[model samples]
Target: MQTRRTFLKTSGCLAAGALLAPNLAKAAKVKDIGIQLYTVRKEMLEDATGTLKKLAKIGYKQLESARSDKGNFYGLQPKEIKKIAGDLGMTVRSGHVHIDKDWQRSIDMAAEAGQTYLVCSSLPSEGQTVANYQRCADAFSKAAEACKKANLVFGYHNHEYEFDKVDGKVLYDILLDRTDPTLVKMEMDLGWVIVTGNDPLAYFKKYPGRFPLWHLKDMDKAKKESTEFGKGQINVKQMLQNMDKSGVKYFFVEQEEYPKTALESAKYDYDYLARLDY
Candidate 1:
């Protein structure tokens, strides 16, 4: 009883549904959103325990610790931090660490903390050349082997500099191409990608499932700095919609600049993400 026009309409509807179904499934699987503690660095330095409690109360279910003057784990030892976060119904699964000669020490500490990831926060050496980046990739592979032995995953967090072109090829691409994918997992910073005028989606497409972690910070287009979620130029909802393509297992909310107190801004970001629907 169906006419040709009706059959065509039904087929188109089914195609659209097929396209949307995967994204919806990925979004629904996302739970236990995390925050990079550096967003509240000052407060954390003064009162690590109290600040973590506040973040936990705000519904953050995971954390990524940043190095502090007090210590790598913010004055407390690795085991101590793990216990505190665990008691609060949260987990400290990753931390930003420097890739230095003492990297093995960092790895040892992270393993003791029950953390799964040790992210190199910056390039170990500074160079804007393809050769330099390739060297860095070699070093990362070595470190990643140590991490594998320690039963931890190693990753790198990129900044805008990585996007610079050398010899007409992006430096980040060189790093990606040279490094072993299993050894060097990338922790993509969404804000920096926008600030550098690069497309995160392009990277996701080029290197699908390589990014297991993300720094979900938004950039203020005018200031070119981090800002509270939903108040920036980044299309966060679009990114979340394509999370499956990025292979993101965990993401951390991080804002370096705030319109108000850090705690208040952290709460705002949490609420914004919690309310956002992909």
Candidate 2:
């Protein structure tokens, strides 16, 4: 079973031994540098194909879309987006889906986009209470089963709300405890986890191999809000050290609030991660 990393290396691009090197000397681990396409939503909406090409040139190999609207892939048809990615030699590993009406259409759209995973980026506002969360958990269980039938992994992305206390227990913990682990994996957004006043490492230690994907963003020191990966207070290097145990297979860079241009923020994240000892 060849992994994406293996496929890229076997394309006669890099030595096999270089693929596993921790420092990633020459972006050998392309999947390691995935971009949450939501970061460039403005550019993507303007020109999906051209944006993908530019991202490929910038060294981004994998992509995670926030969501599709009306059968469109970031504003284009799923098949169109897939073809664009194929032409540019890019991969769409995962995408954001919703918990509402005709989501199956979205699933099929993702399949058309050549995506391997469909992630629920948020819970409906109605699913905000304890009972509602439990209902959402049940829905996730069913959705996960559906994803399995479609040969796609299903996951949930988190926000600060999940960390709030309900009945003296963390809502996030309840969601984790209630959801069928085999059915639903997690795409932990590191920035939101920190913002919710939780320790990212602590959750990793507790969950242990449950997080297959991560949103690697940072929080400002003064504002305590999200910033570019390097200029923020989150200790990403320390967090990344536990990837082996945390089951972090894919990590996508995300910056909801750009201090400057979003591309500049992404470049800073890329340059900083590249320089890390890993």
Candidate 3:
């Protein structure tokens, strides 16, 4: 059985080696940033394909899908979505999915759709105890194993609750400690980390290359909701600066609550990131 401590040690060495890898330098150039479709949920609900085309026209190169009323890929079949996004010169790299009885179906659909990641959008159960987190990790590891067989990566996205302490230990740490690094990866939500008064960099330093995906969001301190990128307190530039440490291969901009229309906020976020120096 692979223990968490051993997994961390092995993953740390791999992360250190990856830091000097040529690809790390290449990734620093910031090419093809993606947007999570949930940011424009209303528009997507109205017209999924058209909304995607608009995003592509706005210079988005990648997309992450969310479960919608129509289906997991917004009313379109998996292959249909892949074709549409491909036609628009954008790839559906990942999607937010539930770790439910239908998980294998989700994985199969993702594989067929050419998606590289199947991220569990939230914790499957309600408990916040360490034991509960451990159980979740075990379940995730099994799911990840199945994902590997399908040639897809399995990841978990976090919210503020994961940061709460249980017996002087962070619940998120328990999950990271319990899961196999090779089997499971993290999609760090930058806004939620700040909202919980935790630092995303600290996790990057602790887990190194384990975080390959990110929800690059900013939070309005006053409203405790996602806002346009620079309008929030998160130091977007600083987070980008530590990409090497975080080992972020791809990131998706996601905003849950916007002052303007979702499409307009999405455009604003794209422009903000495009103009960012790092």
Better of 2 and 3 by TM-score: 3
Segments in model 2 whose C-alpha atoms lie over 4 Å from true places: 1-31, 68-72, 125-127, 221-224
Model 3 clashing residue pairs (backbone): none
Give the per-residue lDDT of model 1 (tens digit) for 91-165.
998999998988999999999989999999999998898878988999889999999999999999998899998
Q: Write one digit per residue (lDDT tens) for candidate 3, span 90-176.
A: 999999999998898999999989999999999887898988899999989999999999999999999889999999999999889
- C-alpha lDDT of all candidate models, in order: 0.90, 0.79, 0.90
C-alpha RMSD for every candidate = 3.9, 10.3, 12.3
What candidate 1 gets wrong by more than 4 Å, as runs, is 1-30
Per-residue accuracy of model 2 over 124-211 as CA lDDT, tens digit each: 5465568888888888888888888888999999987888887788877776889777778999998888877788788878887778
Q: Clash totals for all models, in order?
A: 0, 1, 0
TM-score per candidate, in order? 0.90, 0.85, 0.89
> Among all windows of ten consecutive residues in candidate 1, which has the lowest summed lDDT?
23-32
Per-residue lDDT, model 2, residue 152, is 90
**Candidate 2 C-alpha error for residue 5, in Å:** 50
